[model samples]
Target: MDIFERKPVNHAIHTSPSNDLRLVESAIPDIQPHECLIHVRATGICGSDVHFWKHGHIGDMVVTGDNGLGHESAGVVLKVGADVTKFKPGDRVALECGIPCSKPTCYFCRTGQYNACPDVVFFSTPPHHGTLRRYHAHPEAWLHHLPDNLSFEEGSLLEPLTVALAGIDRSGLRLADPIVICGAGPIGLVTLLAANAAGAEPIVITDLDEGRLAKAKELVPRVRPVKAALGEDAKGFAGRIVSELGQEAKLVMECTGVEASIHAGIYSARFGGSVFVIGVGKDMLTFPFMHLSSREIDLRFQYRYHDIYPKSISVAAAGLVDLKPLVSHRFQLEDGIKAFETASNPASKAIKVQIVDE
Candidate 1:
């Protein structure tokens, strides 16, 4: 191998939702010239990872065969494509998982919505490998420049943060608008942070998990993190929110794709309020569309993200976002299995977990 060649490594991990994941040694990766080689320093375990690990699939994306399982990550540039610009070896950075697949002329891509580009290839899903290894080779355009002040773990979380930002942006939150965020997982808290920066009034987070909810409150005192504990009164809870908030929310961001959360967001919104949905739940659910439509509610589903990376990067680079509190756990490359196992558990002491390079 040439000294500059970004060769594949000897480590990888595979998983399913129902089965405990295992680490496997596989081909590392080789970099093409238009690509860059990243020595991954950190990788996050997203809810999607848990879904895949526990169920062996997420909707249509299945783990029937060999594949690595990670998407959010940061790393160091070990090599660069012959035509690569804006990055060089030794530049520490985060990896953007979505790559424009075969077609480059997609409407989503033409408009810089590469995240929604149907032609884009992504990591850790079926038919495409992920970044759960020591090294990965990817296109240069997808490698984001990380600011020196940010840790690799924070940089790795930029993907989910961007998603949260996009969801909030879609809702068009005004300074005084109220927010009801369903689900207090990493994505939910990221949304809370984004809403907080936007000056949205009183972000309310709902979740069944106490640990996750507690962590969210620690990050933002202004955030009203409420645990929808078992035996808790849903109607009473709704009424209290109305009493405390003064009115129905102008914006509802559903971070948990569960059916219950979806309904909660619907009823939580003020008549005609907009709800931006980024949560991925079961394919279908029974919803009160008649009531929603009667109220003229604008329920919009925000797919990944569109034309938001640069904006998100700027926010992080300029210090507008404090991401340190979001990452609750981390692991080195050698501890890949533990990382996956920890990430797979909802009760595990992690809001967001990462895999770091030694």
Candidate 2:
């Protein structure tokens, strides 16, 4: 098949309101004047995608109809619109996935925090289609060129890396700073890599799964992995983290949405420290308000990333982080439903599951 030739049928994976997945065929999308039509080569299955697949909604964002699922993706440019100037056919690129309003008066977009723009169109989120299809059209400005050293899989992983970068930036992490990471999931693991690259030392990461903790230790040999004991209270888990680090952490990166994990993060931080929440939990969460308040520990929350793609790509290209080790499973696009099933299953021990197009 010619790379530039558009296929007659575009195969896409979508989640319906019935809580089922389907591989459907549709017409290839056309590019706008400033857009580029990309042939998606790789897409990572995110937890949110799985949540939507099983529950038919995330929070108030309901899937009233069939919605394509996938946001972390990489592709080769098949065609560029008349106004597209930075890219040509055959250029490899990673999709940023969030399209925020660029209006000058939009406070969030004008200030460079476009991720918080009220009118932003986020892929895989309810009401907006995503990049799971074979061909997707996106604005050239939203796509970053993939370097020669990075594979399409690595390019797809950049989206989650951006989240880690944003969290690290928001935490004000410094050289050799002692830190605690809650949850050893994909986000937590990527945050560990980012923290190591930033020169943080004696990092302690916690998770309920011993396998994931073992993987975390394998990824960062110097990292101290702490396993959460079954039936242990939040305070007890927090004590365990402190004991493992020999002191309270100055910054806690809470990557799990579990309430116990969140509480443990708050309790594990030292006085005047900060706990940055990167996970998406329930709408209402009850926390130890007085405990955090009395200790002056700032509780910060992070949404999707803003403008960290360039840094993420640079970090990957420079070999500061090896993304390949994180991918535990892979499948072709035709088996996307099975991919989701494996990702959602705990017994599979899957870290980052990806669907690739041959």
Candidate 3:
């Protein structure tokens, strides 16, 4: 049976102007010479997806029309383009949502920081459509082969795992080095797993929700979960984290974009330590400039991942970091609306909500 002989009906989940989700039928995207057509098997709903569905925008990027949602995805190659040499039909693969122009003239691309490329087309961001549908055409270079050990659901998680990997890489984390991570959301939990696998000692994760903290502890038994009080200030919360860890951490990964969390991360770090911000938050935020300067705390920001998918896949394939436990809820593609609702509701306790095609 020739899978490409007849095109399949493609249904995509999109965000409507009424602040609701609508599953709409979209045409199967055509593949370019350097691209391949994918039969999307699994796609994880990111926090940004829910934010766009409920608020109609994220920061400055507003949803203009019925924009498709989802970026963390994996699929099987249904068809390969004429010039595509690395992949073929029936191969399992994971999609790297960002496509950067690899032109030699582009400094960022030339320097291996293609994620910072100005001309990069990142899926599901603003005008660009996403991979929530049954079929999508992606560049061959950005599609990674999934090992037999990893399921499509686990493959879909590679994208977020790369974010965790990138955070660890940017922080210069060392073996047995103590660290603090803010927020127990999917990103933070994955960071905990990655940090643990990297042999970080006495990992501390903070969150306001006890359920999320408990989930973190369940995922990594050695992790210390610290609950933030309702009216706790950054300094007080930082003190709590320090007391939990027995000392100030040399590195803090701020996975929650909340301003308070950012401040707490800085305050929790020892003098001359670093704080790596991995979350997306408000555009304009106030920080303790004088304190940061006086303490010589190096604050860095992490953009989307670059050249980390293969390493992330290897980590999952080797069973060093189990990605399955991160999935708290699952739904079929037809139930994408319900999936979004579950992800947006705090009461659902959904660490990661995924839409599966099969």
| Candidate that scores best on lDDT | 2
Put down candidate 2 lDDT per residue, 1-358, tens digits, no spaces: 6743645668889988898899999778878999999999999999999889888876787899989999999999989999999999999999999999989999999999899898999988988888988889999999999998899999999999999999998889999889999999999999999999999977999999999999999999999999997678999989999999889999999998888899999999999999999987887899999999999999999988887999999999999998999999999988988999899999999999999986
After superposing candidate 3 on the true structure, give the runs of residues whose Cα lies further than 4 Å from its correct spot: 1-7, 16-18
Reference-based lDDT, each prediction: 0.79, 0.92, 0.91
- Give per-candidate clash totals: 16, 0, 0
Tens-digit per-residue lDDT, 55-147, candidate 1: 777777777776678898888998898999889998988788878753556776777666766656888877687887777898987788888
lDDT of 3 by residue, 1-358 (tens): 5544554678899886678788888998888999999999999999888888888787777888778889999999988999999999999999999999999999999999999998888888767889998899999999999999999999999989999999898889999898999999999999999999999998999999999999998989989999988768889999999999999999999998999999999999999999999998988999999989999999999988888998999999999999999998999998888888899888998999999996
TM-score of each: 0.92, 0.98, 0.97
Best by TM-score: 2
> Where does model 2 exceed 4 Å of error?
1-7
Better of 1 and 2 by lDDT: 2
Model 3 lDDT on a 0 to 1 scale? 0.91
Could you tell me how far off, in angstroms, the CA of residue 196 lies in candidate 3 after the best superposition? 0.5
Model 1 TM-score is 0.92
